[model samples]
Target: MPIPSRPRAAALAVSAALLSTSLAACGGDSKDDVDLPSQTLSWKDCPAPSESEGGGEPPSPLPGGTEWQCATMKAPLDWDDPKGDTIDIALIRAEASGAEDKRIGSLIFNFGGPGGSGVTTLPAFGTDYAKLRTRYDLVSFDPRGVGRSAGVECEDAEQLDKYFQQDSTPDDEAERQKLVDNVSAFNGNCEKHSGKVLPHVRTTDAARDMDLMRQVLGDDKLHYFGISYGTELGGVYAHLFPKKVGRAVFDGVVDPTEDPEQGSLGQAKGFQLALDNYAKDCTSQVEDCPVGDTPQDVKDKIAKLLRDLDEKPIPGIFPRDLTQTAATNGIAQSLYSKDFWEYLTEGLQQAYDGDGKVLMMLSDSMNGRNEDGQYSNIQAANVAINCADDKPRYTPQDVEEKLPEFRAASPLFGDYLAWGMLGCTDWAVGGAADHPDVSATGSAPILVVGNTGDPATPYEGARKMAQALGSGVGVELTYKGQGHGAYDSGNKCVSEAVNRYLLEGTVPKEGTVCS
Candidate 1:
């Protein structure tokens, strides 16, 4: 699944991992031996906002009023040239609530953005992780090219607003060229503003930074919790340091085997399945069903609405009108979680009534566009990392060639997603398309969780990830539910199983399904 920093917007999902055969052995190799500094962290009060100020968001689950410690560490900007330039990585640590004797080592967290800010995500969701905080230090860091690190900055909010407002589903060649021109402008801005760091803001580089974190924290082995794109990081880390892997959990797994094109197609099919599920659920409702009773009817209605919006945009609260790209992103974001289905229903109803405010709100939330019209660096970092990790660059013609397969995979979302790949066609840095075979050979049992109806990362990819990790090493835990990431959302079975594994080193039996 393409794990966007925000709820997932603009049809872009970021993922990349290590290819086992391509990378050399971990230790003793010149490339592997970076003399990182060993420094003690001077703990200070974490800057977590109060519950009231946080809009009733629960305080961090850490004991003593949800306080945490923050610090920064230095790492080589380019792992290949360890002695070269350096960059700072931000970190947050909530000490174990339990007695010191009962505490386990640090449990690092990655919330899958190739661009998502761990600094923010951890504080917001740290309460759900209360079960683990008792026995382990809950820690997370913004990956390079992400928040608080050396972030990738592109256009300001005004420019980005115009960018998001552009038509993504082109009809004629002239319209297609407009799409290309917009992407080119965005890419050029990235190169102009952050080109120096863009090449190094890769998954492999982030994984290396993770190892540095482990070392500086004085942990002999690393214990990690990775979701979505973070799973790709964990997979790469396992391949890079199998011996250092300890009790890693990869939820909403990304298949390390697929190339960029294959990955995009797979995600297209996955999102289509999720849309189908939503349609079924919506049609069953006794009231407030915007679309007709049948799935095909619902699909046709939504498709026609999108087509209509493409022709005649709907004016909204914002200065700009609701374009097809924004509308599509708004619809796709709702598929990430079932909780948003009702809101989606409301938004679609409003759209039918010729009001675009609700859908525009959903679109803005998915894009990380705040009330002030400013955007988080999520989109910029997402593009940078995905393009840097995957080498495949498709031209407009190449995308046209693959349009049939993509459309067949997801008639509603395929065309936009297919065109999303073109953003990397003129990428400043060349990425390695083939991810290393991630057997995670010789590592401890790794937990892989999959949401059967997950729209972003499909259920089958999780099964494949487990199989690829080899015998006795990777175990799959199925959450037979909808949404992107499963643990602690609502499934007690999943939460407890993951808790047991992280706390007691207990691996769930194979084929364990949690509802």
Candidate 2:
């Protein structure tokens, strides 16, 4: 399955009042600050592991038998107190296969999750990045609180199963309390098991780590490719090291201007748009469309199915039954990419036939749960990073007041996504850190890619990011296609434009559109 870029929900925009202070704090280390150490990266053979070993399905053998090199770098656990303690950051590199004389510098990658492992994701893109790989060594790393690096592990598989089964859209006070209790319990567990690092996993901290990586790798400036949540990291990096920003591409851009409530509402509308597109395509293209003849009819059917599941969960292939939460997750996962629409059709058909195994499988895949009943730390890290970066200000009453607006934004997905903010209302370890607006003034041109039909991160967010980065520095490349990220979606025009930018340092003309 293609890794979906998880949305980084929190703020719409950074507080302008706090911007100057935070920028001063994060700006490239001053002469008085402690000089960062430079260490040689010892490249070693990449380990090849099976699906059960958290490697996902074994990637196809590298082209021309070119193997990846693995290494680890030390970074301060807390950026504020550099001498206190340190953690190892796992990194992988695939050296340029083209002529060294013509080779450009390393191209670092972050496949958004706030928690997704670049180690697992970058290699999978080897084929897609063939053009750029010839001129730049592709480097990817597990950010501070992500896979392979020190992670945030809140619950084991069993506990997580129960948590996922909880109803996100509560019907009454009792049910709402249950949702609150579950969120509180999850938050407490993260505080207990991952406390020391939870408060330090903010995007700014990870951006600092990236600067260290750039220095260690002997690059005068960083060339970055960040997707979805990764774009948040990239934006922060650009702001901190404006002079050092080199040929950065922020694909599926997240708008750093909206507050938490605005972000959620935007995402609600974005997902709704994607679902509407999917419904139209499904009804028109699929011979045996299971939903209905029209988009509204299709949505009605799905809404009814979710309501039915809420009333009585259906038994699945796994030991646990398919609850409304699981079914909703399954449906949302299918919205990430059109390639998965067929899977959604089949899963929905199976659900209507009283067998929820297919939908349950899709849900499990989204949650990073293996067939062996083990869960990855993706969710744990996702929550930890998001909560730490932007504190939730909405109370239960606040959400209630905004419920109508959320539902108006997305009738099918709004309630759950809005209420999802409840987890961070009282985060145990991390609070909202400064999320300064990113102008990246005086930086090299940065390309911002947006998919018109992207469900997560939404297309407008990309436009806003480009505008925020300053007219001269930020370039917006529009992909008038579906799915989340544009480069790897087999769109020749997008691929060519991005490749040209990365390889030749050529920015696409502003307002360039590729269909």
Candidate 3:
């Protein structure tokens, strides 16, 4: 169970809770002279993150002593009514380190979550993108309904702890009814606490915000880098602002053609594929595999563990136990990066012996729980944006009807993912469309990077995103690797090609392959 969050997020991005905002709602006619495209951002040293942004210390400076600066950009709360209410979109930046003449303006990043705090994430992974920063001021922000940007609140942290512990995959009609009740309560809490902003957190709204950001930053073209769900955002931006596009790369691309149900089904298959790969890698190791002697044995043991947990939970983090849902979530989180496979093996081995702490910790990470036992708004905003973007509202019957297909796609993750399709059930806001429109016929060559082993967003999506972007506008670059994203895998072939494209403006040949 996971999300479009670049990786390490729980299934179908479910769960959201209670928090409130003081974002002012204004009318179109106002005396305010400084609007978003015209407002001057006052950059200053970034303070430690707020609780909603996954509380952490301020970012350290780059290797060359370049400090990470923070700023707030104003955008209309509702894009349709341009002069209406506004929200503060938190931003972070590391000024280009190269000479002024060599600079290529800013590279705005959106690292998927639809809910991730870019203000925080960019710094956490600052060094990873430092090479690109040499010639471009690397910038990222908290999108509307996300952390520190008028974030959407639902249940309180305590309530969410209970929410995550409850059975998400219902086995009987009574359990199904209870599951629905829980979801409705969660959605109801969201409306009760943050109704004003729920209606406006669509992906299209974020895309327009990005355009305003590009203009305010004095960039004629929007040089961008998008990962996971960020890729979907980039596609929508390209579709809307074709001429303004420049040096864009989409990694772990989403299939822009699928509706909600189709997308979920694809993710089911993707996660299963990742599980299969993980199994093969583990058992094929030179040293004896810790979990199992064969790939099928590895998967079989995992399935049995889940079934057993469903019957009797095991001791996890003090006061909590690793239930079936948590175990499923933890396993999915580990699959996000191959580096985490060892942790999965360790957790699984420990679980076999009745210790569930490692697995629960992994699940906590997926749900954005810090070591202090507090939760972030990642799951909340993820639901807010995804719900507002996807038009389909599924009922239990719809899921029950589709369970067989999902299970066939992924025996381990099938039911977990199938049940996730109901995340938007009775949501307060009406979604914008069945799927995003990513047809940018006249845009520049936008590189679309697809990893063959990406779990959250499957490998097939790269080609779909490219094909949807229209002929020459989309340049497809394939990375034959594992993990949620290509460039982040530290593969030299993939990194060199992306560097040449983004830094030197040399798009790799349309079908270039990297391993």
Candidate 4:
């Protein structure tokens, strides 16, 4: 989350334009219990924030630009009861500048990780988005159970260490029992400690939080961008309030209908596909590629190595005890971006020779272990959010049935990922079943962006999401490159297209592909 950064403010003396409208007219609240009809229409250009009336402190001062005000929006903990207890989500907005620049509504940004905190990343990455920040207010927040604003804290770091170190993939009955016990302990501790807020941290709840923020910002509709898990949150918002969507973008789209087990299974297959691609690309360039012989041979080598590590983790090479499960998982994560593939390929080659430093680093990043021997809140929150959002389809029969398929998909990783999904069964929070298919039929057009080679959220998921949001436009930017999120990946075609869409009220023509 910290890798991306944000810039500071330049005073345009922008006026805060409050566009207040009635929900009754918008069909946002239908008390008669009748389904409201959604109608698509052209989006209207809205005025920017009034520089004079931005009457609070200037944006929080940052390293580069001047910081604006930190605003808090009241959102429902549970969407079902609008009148129920509300939680305050803290937001930071950086205003744009230049007289020639036309100010649009707020552009809310979310970097994935159902657990990823965006507020921290905004200031960190604002400088890169300076031009866009000049056009619209760049806004982000620490969602519930995240940083700054009320976050969920667990039993101390020591307890967390044990939780993460627990074996993910079980090869034997004893290992499986250990995995199950660790899962149960971790979840039980969550219930014992953060149980009150655990149930309210689902993706749908986050979407509702976005709407409340939209209203607070005085925007009639939502202008949003979400990555990875953020796409799932955006999709839910679009589905629940399609009429409220405004210039929305969902990258690394997650198919809401897919259950946890299926979702993880799909991810396993996706990683395998990426690995295959990496193998082909690397082998073809033997001079640059450390991976040897053929793609099949490389795959076999990795499988063999993982099997060896499973039995006895190599000593003194890594910070944590190296296990076949952790190594493969780390490798899978590296596949998310092609830039990281070189590192992984090299790591694989080294590990094949008994050196595990490179592989260990990959493992550390995926598992969120830091040099200080601490874990990033990402791992905890990722597990909590995924488990809480959807129930695993992992029964004895289910695992038995899928074991071979997973193994076939990932010789070294299949069974391990399967157990990771199974760990969700111990989650205390109930699961989400209702998929709020975001049609946003009547609202401003939404943009669904997909990277063809995104490993985490495959391109197909983005295509399906675009199809689901009939009122939305799908901008297929073929990166031919590999990365989890593409718009910010420096692809001229992709960024330019997105900038044009956001700045002008134009949606790329339907099924428009930017290669």
Candidate 5:
């Protein structure tokens, strides 16, 4: 199944009070008088595995042709003091099967979730990444506060259910206040329940851990492939240790310098762009399409439908029903991938018919719900990382500041998602780190790919991120295609270019466009 591309939930605009401190220090060290523990790790002598992993036992082999193994290391919670409390970093390695002595260094892979679990996903889907796996020892790990690696867990299933039950878009002051209170309570709960792991969950710490993994594998240079927020993490790594970068690829890049509010407003516009594409695709199939001739009319119809549903939810069959939030989420998610247009049209038709089951399913997927009606840990991690990364600078007065742009860009979703910054105002965690610029002046050339119609990460972000990196350049792969990440979804031109870059260390020219 295609992964849904929702907006980064917690990237609020930073406050002036939070930007006074510098963010240039690397290895997690701060310039303050009180030094924090140095967040570094070194590998010790250990027996090499009889062979790389694949085909077998209790630990289970990775599914692809590559071989796999496990490694663990210790990193300090704070990065200045070498003696501070330590956290364990869990990693999995998948080695190339060519001539044993000719193996290139390890290639690290991360699929963007400030919470996405690479360790879990790599084993099964590692095959799709065969080009890189065949040349380097492919490595994946659970960054701190994620999956198997001492991940932070939150509210019980029921409370979490209640949390999702609350509306993300508030129609009035009472509803807005409720959202603020719920987000604050959620943040408080994370601090109370995961304090031991909270402070260590920063992206800088995760980058440090990646460096340690590079050492454990005995690689002097690092080759990395990071997607989505993974691009953000990769950017941070490149900034801190530019010289250590190997063949790095960042697809669906996020521009680090963008203020959250401005960035999200841009994202709202990007989504609308993708939605317009979806509408065109939908019209091609006259039977299932529900949109009107012009994009404006289609958008207006959607707005009226949402308002109508909000006042009186559209009921489904025996076991399902659609709340305003679910319907909205479904429409939003479908806009991310043109491949989803058919399904989205069906969903819209059902919503129009007062049976919201299909739309509800899309919403469930957007929120990561399982068949058993359980939610994944993704939502918590999404909120935590984003909140910790930036602070909300919007005030009641500021609401009017960008309202016109937002409304014009996203008719149905503008006000609701643009105002999502309010959730961070009540966060107990306070502000974010000062620096947002992540460049790799000393690292090898990294490949950054962008799709023109990406809803989550705008194409312009790809251009901006490429500009930020000292040695990197952005490749505007014109995906006459639509989707969040376009790497493995079959555009031979794109896959071949990326594969050649990863397997042979060939950086395509600056303005390389793959259609």
Candidate 6:
């Protein structure tokens, strides 16, 4: 929805809180009535993440010397034609450490992005979920159209570098046209490179793949841990296979009720809220808030800086300058977690002095471009999946009509987010729906966790998700903390609540609040 910023591309890394899990190593078939090929999984020692998965070293072994294993499951390329050509759904797992007799089945995770490589992410954050691993094999996977899973490829790094540099919030007709042309060109690149895969990368297709994955993994029911966009995916899965949902947890829940336009607008307000909170938190500290004299002063200064960057770019990351768009993205990336607030502060201070390296790095991280200038397929897949799932293709007039409302939501972020509507304007594939359908009348209870200070997937989304998931299917948990997802917050109540539900099948009381 929101052209893949925190609205969310789940703004990857999920900030330090989500990724702060113990670093380690990190599938599916068609929708309904999948007749998966009967085959035993041949798991092997995991290899280093592929270039599309954000090139990195192989995951280190877990704390107790349990190594991560990787496998690939074949799923139908198109669920509508279940017996059609297959696509490999990359999977990774760490077997349960507890006694075999006591071990539950697999506990799968999807960390949003619609694009993030679970093949890489699960290992990096393995230890954080060790408790869950005590009884269940911790599992995650690269959904179809993601890394190592027939990944979608678009523009190369050099093209993307220039793509990100262009002004996103167009001010005039010519600038608007240029922005549209750039978006069209980028979308064109995706179609030219991965057209065959684009049409089948919808969330429904991935949901179907998960059902097939359940069969291949020998899990009677899908025990999922979904975060950010992962939450949306989980909801869609529940909708498709209600009885198959078992002990699921959705944190950083996406609002399934809103269309792309509404969702993007919601993000503008959410990011603004996070920014305001950051300002207040900083200025109230014992030492001076280096960025400003007061909370409002802090915001004013940031607004001014963005305006300044728009007029004149600052030196950043050697040859790459930090433009207004880059700084905004960087700031948005930092606000994904309270731990990253320090980086935001430092980035702002550095930018103030004409040193834009830090901000550019943050922006680079958001765009899935590493220091080596190699770009991951996350951006490409993000657009592919989102354009395939979302039904609306907003025009400039639609954005212009909504400009006042978006501006009223957040002065610092409104225009940038509003302009993002054009991202899928020229997408080759037709979208599935205006918004996802998450209604699951006979589904198992899904614990939906929402953070009060979430900058993406705002707090209201949790209530909406719960209500939409239908009575008895979605239980709401409120965490009075700052970050993208609640489980990773290390909040005693949130962790206990989630753990108890997933492990013991003990549902927390509805509307339960945790700090």
Q: Rank the candidates by TM-score, best first.
A: 6, 3, 2, 1, 5, 4
Cα-based TM-score, every candidate: 0.91, 0.92, 0.94, 0.83, 0.84, 0.95
Global Cα lDDT for candidate 6: 0.85
- The residue pairs found clashing in candidate 6 are 22-128, 23-124, 24-123, 25-123, 26-123, 28-209, 29-209
Compose the digit string of candidate 2's lDDT tens values, residues 410-514: 998889787876868558764564354577888999999999998878899998898888869889999998877788778999989999999988889999999
Instruction: Write candidate 5's Cα lDDT for 246-288 as tens digits.
Output: 7888887787778777677777787778777776766656564
Cα error of candidate 1 at position 112, Å: 0.6
lDDT of 5 at 302: 79
Q: How much is the lDDT of residue 366 in candidate 2? A: 68
Count of clashes in candidate 5: 12
lDDT of 2 at 301: 89
Q: What is the overall TM-score of model 1 with all chains considered together?
A: 0.91
Encode model 6's per-residue lDDT on 104-158: one tens digit a residue: 7999989887688888888877888989998999999999999999999998888
Tens digits of lDDT, candidate 4, 185-245: 7778777877778888877677767766676565787888777777777777777776677
For model 4, the local distance difference test gives 0.62
Which sections of candidate 4 miss by over 4 Å? 1-64, 68-72, 79-85, 286-288, 316-319, 391-393, 434-436, 471-479
- Poorest stretch of ten by lDDT in candidate 6: 21-30
- TM for candidate 2 is 0.92
Cα deviation at 335, candidate 4, in Å, is 1.2
Q: In model 5, which regions exceed 4 Å deviation?
A: 1-71, 286-297, 316-320, 393-397, 471-480
lDDT for residue 369 in candidate 5, whole number 0-100? 55
Task: Name the runs in model 3 displaced over 4 angstroms.
Answer: 7-37
Give Cα distance to truth, residue 123, candidate 4, Å. 3.1
| Per-residue lDDT value at 269 in model 3 | 93
